[model samples]
Target: MPNAEKLRSAARLQYKRAVLWSHARRGDLVCRLMLHEHLADPYPLYEGIRAEGPVYRSRAGVQAVTAHELCGQVLRDSAFGRRNEDAGTAEPAADGPPAAADAPAGGGNASFLDGEVADHMRWRRLVAPAFRTRKIAEYRHRTEEVAHRLLDAALDRGGDFDLVTDFASPLPITVISELLGITDVDVDRFAHYGLVTGRAIDGVRSVRQATEFREAAGELDAMFTALVRRRRDEPGDDLVSDLLRPQGDERLPEQEIIGTCQLLLTAGFETTTNLVSNAVLRLLSDREQWEALVADPKLAPAVAEESLRYDPPVQYSIRVVRDTLHLGGVTLPSGTVLMLVLGAANRDPDVFPDPHRFDITRPDAGQHLAFLSGAHYCVGAPLARMEADVALSVLAERLPELRRAGRLRRRPTAALRGLLNLPVSSGR
Candidate 1:
């Protein structure tokens, strides 16, 4: 019986893929996004979708929003929300056609993608304090220290090294591990889990990937569960301990604490890793941009902001309509999903003149919604910015002659835009 069910699910998924591919071949802009050939460069598709109109209805029954204003408005509107397991919105990937049966659902209690509203707000509130202004400020010095230390090791290795592995990736892993008060670090193990889980953001493509995600989630849950228990008895000065701290007379539920730690652990490192790598890749791609940063490494923050606007790590976000809302000159029924194409929105010509050009000094680069806006704005935006600022500045100052050593490779996932390997030399 179980085998029959599995076979049926796989068949359904395949059928959905066939439908998407058929529509894509017939010139469906949204369906084209799910194709591998287009994932590496999706801007053209975004522009196509935008050209059609602000709101495009995919053959898959979801709507896509590519305009900056419309995407921002949908994200900020209280009537729209993330579809979590609690809401049964996790049935499939609403961003495009249905994914594999085991594909993870939209954010909810699972990991903050699309969960129940009350639960989402409560979790956000409980975790918000740890990422408050003062708290993030406190981590800045340590972030710089980590960036410097990682660069020192990369330099010592000599010849060409992968920027993604040697520098960009490890820096955030070390920092987040410490912040979570995780002792006895397992860099290789945790990094693997983070990669698998991060790619799940794009939706699991196969049974093997689904299985791996389950194992990774289980391991992380076990680790955090133990940590929470330990913090309860002997708390430390870390985010985990702080979260476990009681609220007045009652303590946060176990699931909420676990969910908060999971969110911090995954989002804290994954997004920042891409930010640093994407920034460096963009700088190196254009010699003048690279030279400009080398000329004034102090402009690292500006470079970071520009990278977020030019080529953000996160390409798009999804929102499910909760009510019959009128937007983009169209009426969307309740339960409609909008794939807010953030990357395209960032490059919207109306909002950003000369949108395709990457200029670090663009005064309004900070206006981009790379970190999103409104109630679900990324809580780790501050930490990510600080980390990238320090990382970029340190790299420019230390290796002013940095240049690409080999062909760059981007991650296979479409939702998260980042380098899988960026081989570079110090020009030594």
Candidate 2:
């Protein structure tokens, strides 16, 4: 009885629903990657996406959610699980053994990100001490010293250079590698590993495109196996030693320790790397702020906080649903993946005044969720802070005539947006 027009409408409706439920396409790597950089500058895109609908299960079927309050709600809610999900999940506790079904296959790449919730929680408990406030404070002087040395050498060179390469990206890697008792291999190689890993695992990888991931994951696992054994045999006075030499039966199992080391290396190294790069890009864009920092190094700490707010390191993190959730203006179905675009949320005008403006002097600048909210917060937050403070102070003091040479280019990774190469010149 239906006419051709009605038949076409029905077909369109069916297609729409089909896109929302299919996971086969969700595993596609190349085509889905077109959305990578767009998600990097996600606010404007998110605004348009939000207008269409709060939650849109993509053609790939991985649900993407982008709103301020909604992000907070999802992240804070425990029911929005990250274990055994359609999209992906994180290892249960950093230091606990892998879950029953999610055990390391030994041969294949392990799904370290997806495991039982309790194991994830246990992992979180074991690694808590190393990232605690006091521990980070102890590392501050050293982080600053490294930053000062890098910038001072750049100033001594007295020529055009890339901010990201010369200083931002490498500094945090050096600091973290030393802290984790990882020496022998070149720091620069690990820096490359950090960048590649951050780019791959942080949803920047095409779910289908995991070849690079296989290589990186394998090398990392092999590297960690050796490191873990080394720690057990001859522990040092650093984080690895702490994890290896935990109090009493508080020790982590071998597989759990491997996963934890991988997480810590990635988290501690990459997060601060992006943080430093993001801050420098913000500074280069805002010449006045750059000049101000050059005038007073004291502004370093506050400016670093503002950078975390203005352009955070980790852009979007995902949470899996265990219960139906209502947030912002949309209700998410149980078991769906909710993508929390922190960069977009940080710019939410509801929470921050003139959220778009990169104002270091802004009083409420520190309130941003750059370090995240609640229990799953960043453990290396203080170390990141110290690293930035030292680096910024050194840049201001040493590079008096630090000025841009070319347009800043951001990295391709959606989850961590920072300069790939920020060109600048200083007076010789």
Candidate 3:
């Protein structure tokens, strides 16, 4: 999604017919919106999708799930599979996941990095314990420390620098790094791999642009192989070590464990980074909201909540149907792809009154689907919220005069929404 307009214009559209032999295409059956259309804001699109009905059958077997009622059903209900998790990277081309072979030129967000649905219940089980509600509380102090350290560096330098590189990217990386006990060597290695991973799997980026991404994935696998070996011998007080520890009778494979850790680091870092940056971007543009948070620190959390609803870091997600399920007037057969418009749905008026308003005090702010729903909902949702809440509180408290330095640059990721670089003036 780095160059959205370019990617949109360049991608060759492949239309699929419902009956294969028939002219009835999925795109023709439902309201289809290009990935770019939802860029920046997608509420109007969501409203339109919602009006179409609960179950919208589009061309190419795509079922557009818009309303909170249906979205929640698809996510929470047991009828759907997470889509990509179980299927691996090789497929008959649905929502283009990172292909099995990362094209030699691939370097941007792969097709469906975050949307891979694998063992929703088991996947959740393996990771939920680490990021559970109770455990997330313990990371606050560390999150605050990391946020302060990054903010201090940015504030003290007193010069123009990208908030993402200078702030957002580092903030969450540092926290997760320390949590995973990754330092020095592992840090840089993960940083590079993280960027590659971000662009390759991010729904926003293109498939061919992720050449470096596949290379990084290979390197990451090798690195984790070494790390897991070390952790097995000498366990550390970090996540990787815990994941490697024996789990009764369900011992995790080194690769799967690596994938799990890599997934966490990639997902955990960018999202929180995006959350911090996106919230900062929204606040910087709205003078009143910025001033409100600076005045009343309690409003910081509210600001984070509202930002998730307003300009969420991660946008839409895709789900695959397991069996023929009836929704609205349509009955989608198994393998029907459902594109969940998370960002658009958050702004749906039917769900939230004055959907366009970014009111921090709005009670509906918490009701947004930014973290998603059901078993596959983001495992680190609580941790992400806590991290942002703490980071924003610290940033507002420390650099009270922070203001946008220039036109903030957005990270081209449509899925992970936020600023790639937000130049801001602070400490004066």
Q: State which candidate has the highest lDDT.
A: 1
C-alpha lDDT (0 to 100) for residue 297 of candidate 2: 87
User: In candidate 3, which residue ranges exceed 4 Å CA deviation?
Assistant: 1-38, 84-87, 90-118, 185-192, 202-208
Local lDDT at 102 for model 3 = 20
**Which consecutive 10 residues in model 2 have the weakest lDDT in total?**
92-101
The whole-model lDDT of each prediction reads 0.78, 0.65, 0.65
TM-score of 1: 0.93
Order by TM-score, highest first: 1, 3, 2
Model 1: lDDT equals 0.78
lDDT (10s digit) by residue, model 2, range 1-428: 24665555456545533443343256422113324536446556655555655465554434555557777776676777654355232311111111111222221333233444566566667667776777877877777777777767876776888788878877877777787788874666676666666555443223222344446667878988898788889888877677776666566777777766666676676777778777877787788999989899899999998988888887666666787766555676776655565777788777889888999898888778888665566666877888888888888887877778898777766566776788888765
TM-score head-to-head 1 vs 2, winner = 1
Task: Report RMSD (Å) for each prediction in the order shown.
Answer: 2.6, 8.6, 6.0
lDDT of 1 by residue, 1-428 (tens): 27777676567657767887898899887777866557667888788888898899888666888888988887787888665234453223422432321233212235444454675676677677877889889998898898888778887888578899988888888888999999987777876876786677665555566567667877888888899899889999998888787767656677667766776777788889999999999899899989999999899999999999999988877777887879989998887777888999999999998999999999989989899888788888988988898899989998998999999888877777888889999988
